[model samples]
Each structure stands twice: as C-alpha cells, then as structure tokens.
Target: MKTEGGADAAKRRAGERAAEEVEGGFVVGLGTGSTTAHAIEAIGRAVDDGLDVRGIPTSFQSRQLALEAGIPLTTLDAVEGIDLSIDGADQVVDDADAAAFGTLIKGGGAAHAREKFVDAAADRFVVVADPSKLAARLERPVPVEVLPDAHTVVADRVGDLGGEPTLRSAEGKDGPVVTDNGNLVLDCEFGPIDDPETLAARLSRVPGIVEHGIFVDLADTTYVGTDDGVEERQY
Candidate 1:
C-alpha cells in the first residue's frame, strides 16, 4: 500500500536517479518545480560529499534550492557548454515520432522560457518525474511568457491560435504571476495537443511571446518514479 508520503517518495526516486547523472566538473542545468527540487537537494547532498559540479538554475526557486543545497552555480555566459540538464514536466507524451526522443509540456511554475534555453544547450537533457506525469498525449495548459507591454496582443494572438488564454494570477499575491525576466504569463488551454511542434511554432510566431511550455524532443532520457520503483526510459 502507498503511504501518505508515497507521491513524494516516487518523485524522490526519480529525482535522485537523475542526480546520479551529474559528474565531477560538469555544469548542470537545474530544472524548476517540486519534483526537480528533490534532485537539486540530492545534488546538494552530493556536493557536501565532494562532488565538484556547477549548476545553472532555471528560475529563482531553482536558484534558491541550489544555493541551499550548496551546489555552486554559474551563468551561461561563464560556461562553454552544459554537460546535462535535469528538468520536470507537467505532462510527458508517448508519441510515435521516430525522429523525436521525448515530448513534454512544462512551465507549470512559469519558468519555461529559461528552462527551454538551458535544456536545449545541454549535451544531454534528462527529465525526472513521478509516474503520474506520464500520459499518452499532452493535455495540460501551456504556459506562455510574454513581455508585459505585449500581454494584450499576445493574448489575442494566442486566441487566434485556438487557445483560450488567461493571464496567470498569483496564488497569495494580488496581481498576476511574473516571470524571472519580469514578464507576464498566459495559461493557454487548447485541449489535447495532438501536434505540439505545430502549436509551439504557432505560439513562437506571435510577437512578444518570449517562450511557451510545449517542449518537444528536448529530452534524451527520463527517470519515471513509480510506486514500485524507479523506471528509466531512454529516448
């Protein structure tokens, strides 16, 4: 039977497995979200145990976690290339595309823009998630970050793309949620996305759209945490 901490344990299993991918002298792209936080903490523990690696965090939250974990961080401007990136996904889709390794929807924390930039630069990008994240198709609302001035225009363009766009509001604060880059977020619902690339392309063409959460073919491998154990899937 699953304990009260079952979900957390599953996330931890997957996260820690991804942490094992980090090596001495490697520059890692730290991912955002609670699941990814486990990996960050694990990496921190490894750092305390003598791992010599630097981290490039995807968001403020990730940066804070990495700092707490004692994982040294460097900027992209300071690095030649990233060795690996460990990220989390809102949804992971198993598709039939022979050309693609993995398809994912991310940015639930409104950090997708930065996450994509870091993940794409990695020599190997790994996703860490619990089994609940895996799915047959992408069904989550895509988070789109846009310049504050272009919010209205981008929202309209998102509607043109057949997505219902809503400005993402903060939970505890009064106003909308803002990105680390000081941009606003639009949670766009287009329903089950059959072709994420096409949608991503469409979203990208919209001026003021910094980045969207539709991450297609960026991951090389995934560690999925199940109730029974951690499962490794090669993409």
Candidate 2:
C-alpha cells in the first residue's frame, strides 16, 4: 500500500520505465492522461538528450503536451505504423495465462476513441499505471462514444444490455462532455465485466456507437509501479 503522494511518484516511475522502450527514429504514439503525461515529459527529456523520435499523439491534449515537451509530431496519415504506444489505463486485468492478452478500461479523460486507434496501429501497446489500477475484474463503467444525435438511442440500447448508462457531463459546462471526435460519451455501468471482448463486440454493433472504452486483447504488456519498484507483466 502507498500514500497519495507515494502513488503519484510510483506512476511517474512506471511512466519513466515505459519511456525506456523508445528508440531513436521510432514513431511513437503519445497517449492522454496523467500517467502518460509523465511518459511524455520523459520522452521530451530524451529528445533534448538527442533521442530523435516522432510522436503520433492520440488527442489534442497529448499533442499540446508533446509540443511543450519538445518532441516532434507526426500524423497517422504520415506514418505506416507506430513502433510503440504507452498509455494509462483506468483499470487493468491481467489474464492468468501469460500468453493471453489482458483487458483494459480507459477513457477517463474522454479520449479513448482516438487512443484506441493509435494504440491499435502500434507494433506494441504498453500500459503504464500505478498498482492501484490493477484489478481482478473490471468494475468501472465502460465509456461508449456515440454520435450526438444518437445518444438517446444508444443509452436505451446500453440499458438493454444490463448496464445503467449515464451521459458523461462536463464539469464546468452545462451540456454533456463532447469528445475530440465531436461525439457524446455514455458511461455504462456493467459491474465486474466477465467477458470484455464479447461486450466490446456487442457495443460495436450498436448503431451510432463509434467506439467503446473496453480495450480487449490490445495490450502487449503492462508496467505497474509499486512501493518496491516497477513491475512488468507481459500479455
């Protein structure tokens, strides 16, 4: 167990460890969120030290961060494929078999839709997190990005799937939170998801649902920071 400040430090350690995977001339995917912010900063420092890497940011926030960190930027259309992607996870479930891929629930920052695209395009998708993010089963609400006009319909469909759906609202704004893709997000609570792959597929079939936050069979490895040190788990 760790105190609040210790947890933040652990996350930074995990982020730094993940940054070590970067190599010169590699096209990396920059992910959004607090944990990945540390990785972005580490990568920026490496760039200052002569690490020549181009970044494909997953969101506007990441793009801005990369700019401030002095990391060069590129677009998905400009690259064939990304060498690697390091992102943060809201929840991580490591499979029992090391050969099997693990599950991740993301979109805490409302950027999972773009994050998934960049992550899937990478040769390896690595998750960086603090120990508190690891879970036996995913209990968080899966965020579903839907077309603004389709939010009502999508909410009904999600409810039919045994989830309680709530439109993610902005903290300072009056309306619902809109994603970078100009879509509405539905936070659907499906307690302790047993089969994320199945649920993801089912959600995909729902019309107007652009993407879901349930990342299934995508993560190649996870770097978790603990009181002892950074722990690596390969999926």
In order of appearance, the predictions have TM-scores of: 0.95, 0.95
Which segments of model 2 are wrong by more than 4 Å?
1-5, 95-101
**Which 10 successive residues of model 2 have the least lDDT summed?**
93-102
Residues 1-235, candidate 1, lDDT per residue (tens digit)?
Answer: 7643588899988999999989999999999998899999999999999999999999999999999999999999999999999999998875546333378999899999999999999999999998888877888899999999999999999888899999999999899998999999999999988778889898988999999999877889989887777888787
TM-score of 1: 0.95
Per-residue lDDT of candidate 2, residues 4-122 (tens digit): 35888889989999999999999999999889999999999999999999999999999999999999999999988899999999999865652224799999999999999999999
In lDDT terms, how accurate is model 2?
A: 0.91
Give the whole-model CA lDDT for all candidates, comma-separated.
Answer: 0.91, 0.91
- Residue 205 shift from truth in candidate 2, angstroms: 0.5
Clashes of 1: 0
